[model samples]
Target chain A: GAGVSQSPRYKVAKRGQDVALRCDPISGHVSLFWYQQALGQGPEFLTYFQNEAQLDKSGLPSDRFFAERPEGSVSTLKIQRTQQEDSAVYLCASSLFGQVIYEQYFGPGTRLTVT
Target chain B: QQPVQSPQAVILREGEDAVINCSSSKALYSVHWYRQKHGEAPVFLMILLKGGEQKGHEKISASFNEKKQQSSLYLTASQLSYSGTYFCGTEFQGGSEKLVFGKGTKLTVNP
Candidate 1:
């Protein structure tokens, strides 16, 4: 009955530092997605996974961003050498059947600040 | 590409009505509507599939004009609780797993 959850509700990193955000999807959710939301803007898709496979990563902003869902249940998004431009809210969502028709359940998201 | 949303923002008195529009340049498979309050996750409002489908949620409803590659979200008799940013997510014909969101329309309802 639990919804999606993310860790480190808030994170502050110095420029050039590295950060990792975690996402715990609802039980048995087969599809997971990550998005980035800049201030006053709609969320931008970053990556997506089906089961344990990273099906879509085209939306990732750069090579420095990486994501993994090795077990198909939990996922982690890592950023190497963070910059002020990387500051944003990182959101995670999951769906029951990996279908676009099903509504997604979103997490509270991790707000990352780069200074 | 991100869909375009009109009127970047809107302000209305309680019990008034509002309409938000989303238009895309490419063919779409489905359209999704979401509402997000400040510092919170987006909550799903409804979805409209291709073929000009219409769906309703409480006092809010949406219509998709597949032929025109556009969708409209209608909220009548607005309430304070409806104050938030509204986003329209478009799923293109070939990309079912991803959604491209519009810039969002800020809605403020005053009592």
Candidate 2:
């Protein structure tokens, strides 16, 4: 039983460039979530998906952020025209069945540095 | 809105006890507690549903007061391994499943 995993452990991007971070949820997981954590702060929700349907995106900071879970297993978070403020660690999590009370399994996360 | 966590930071000696509190301004449906070590993803500790159920894990336990929209995590005999940042994520009643998290409470346990 592998846990959730994220790719590109670290990414350095120039301001205004676009970057995409990937996540692989646990097998058979039906709920996936994305969050952003800045230094010295808690993780802030970004978006969520339930079986490929984007259920919640209200937590997204701005229009520049976009995410998708096309296959209901893997997901991607894309940031357009990245700003220095976008520099943070991007985390992905998943639960077995999208249950409100299910404990989410988290990925190692991808640290993005906008220079 | 994000919940507020008390005692932004705390220091404890091994075998001591500590409490971390989280409060929300709105009605809550569920509360989730998580711990994250430096450079690592947050690890789920326990969750309390709207029923105000109390849960325990090892020497760590938590109680949720649904009526007050607050939750408290209690750690007894704190271990060095318990040193990390604790975050409380709250799901408001009538809100989507998205969780709004508190800033976090940093706990440092020394031998």
Candidate 3:
């Protein structure tokens, strides 16, 4: 089976530009999550979705960030007016169950660099 | 709060053993371990739930201590393939589904 995957492995944008990163979770995974990882640091939570319903978004840095999982499988994280601080690798993960006890399968991630 | 991991980095030789520890201030429901190579996604090593259960792989093992809100990952007879950054993700008992991660422990195994 194919593992989790993300599109646009790398991206560079002007500070004020908007960017959208896409994620394709493992087939049939009901729980999806997004995270941000800065260089030499651990991944920080961003948001999560259980099917089409977003269960949590408290980890989002600010209003400039938003995410959606409309069909419950594919997800997108959009950043408006990107800042240099927003430069980091965006990671997407998924688990078979909604429970936190389940192991999360991660994607390669999309590295976003804001200039 | 983010859990704290000990020994920010470690260097080892093949056939040796090492232990990485994680401690959380808040009560935890589970501890998840992951290893990541340079320029790659994190790979799940194991998950330890509450109740102090121990899980094992060929040469890897983990233990959860609910009372202390801590977990330990053990690597025995280390292999070259085991070199990478190890992270511990803590899920609070009453917190959301998100897992708060520690900085990371970089492990380098030399042959």
Q: What is the TM-score of chain A, computed separately for every candidate?
A: 0.98, 0.97, 0.99
lDDT, residue B104, model 3: 97
Q: Is the docking of candidate 1 incorrect, acceptable, medium or high quality?
A: high
Which whole-number lDDT from 0 to 100 does residue B30 have in model 3?
90
Greater-DockQ candidate between 2 and 3: 3
**CA shift of B16, model 2, Å:** 0.2
Question: Share of real interface contacts recovered by each model?
Answer: 0.69, 0.76, 0.93
Compared with the true structure, what per-residue lDDT tens digits does model 3 show for residues B1-111? 899998899999999999999999999989999999999999999998899999998899999998899999999999999999999999999856889999999999999
What TM-score would each prediction reach against the true structure? 0.98, 0.98, 0.99
Candidate 2's DockQ: 0.81
Residue B75 in candidate 2, Cα distance off native in Å: 0.1
In model 3, the fraction of reference contacts reproduced equals 0.93
Q: Mind giving the per-residue lDDT tens digits that candidate 1 earns over B14-94?
A: 999999999999999999999999999999999999999999999999999999999999999999999999999999998
Native contacts retained by candidate 1: 0.69
Clashing pairs in 1: none
* B98: Cα error in model 1, Å: 0.2
Quality of model 1 by C-alpha lDDT = 0.95
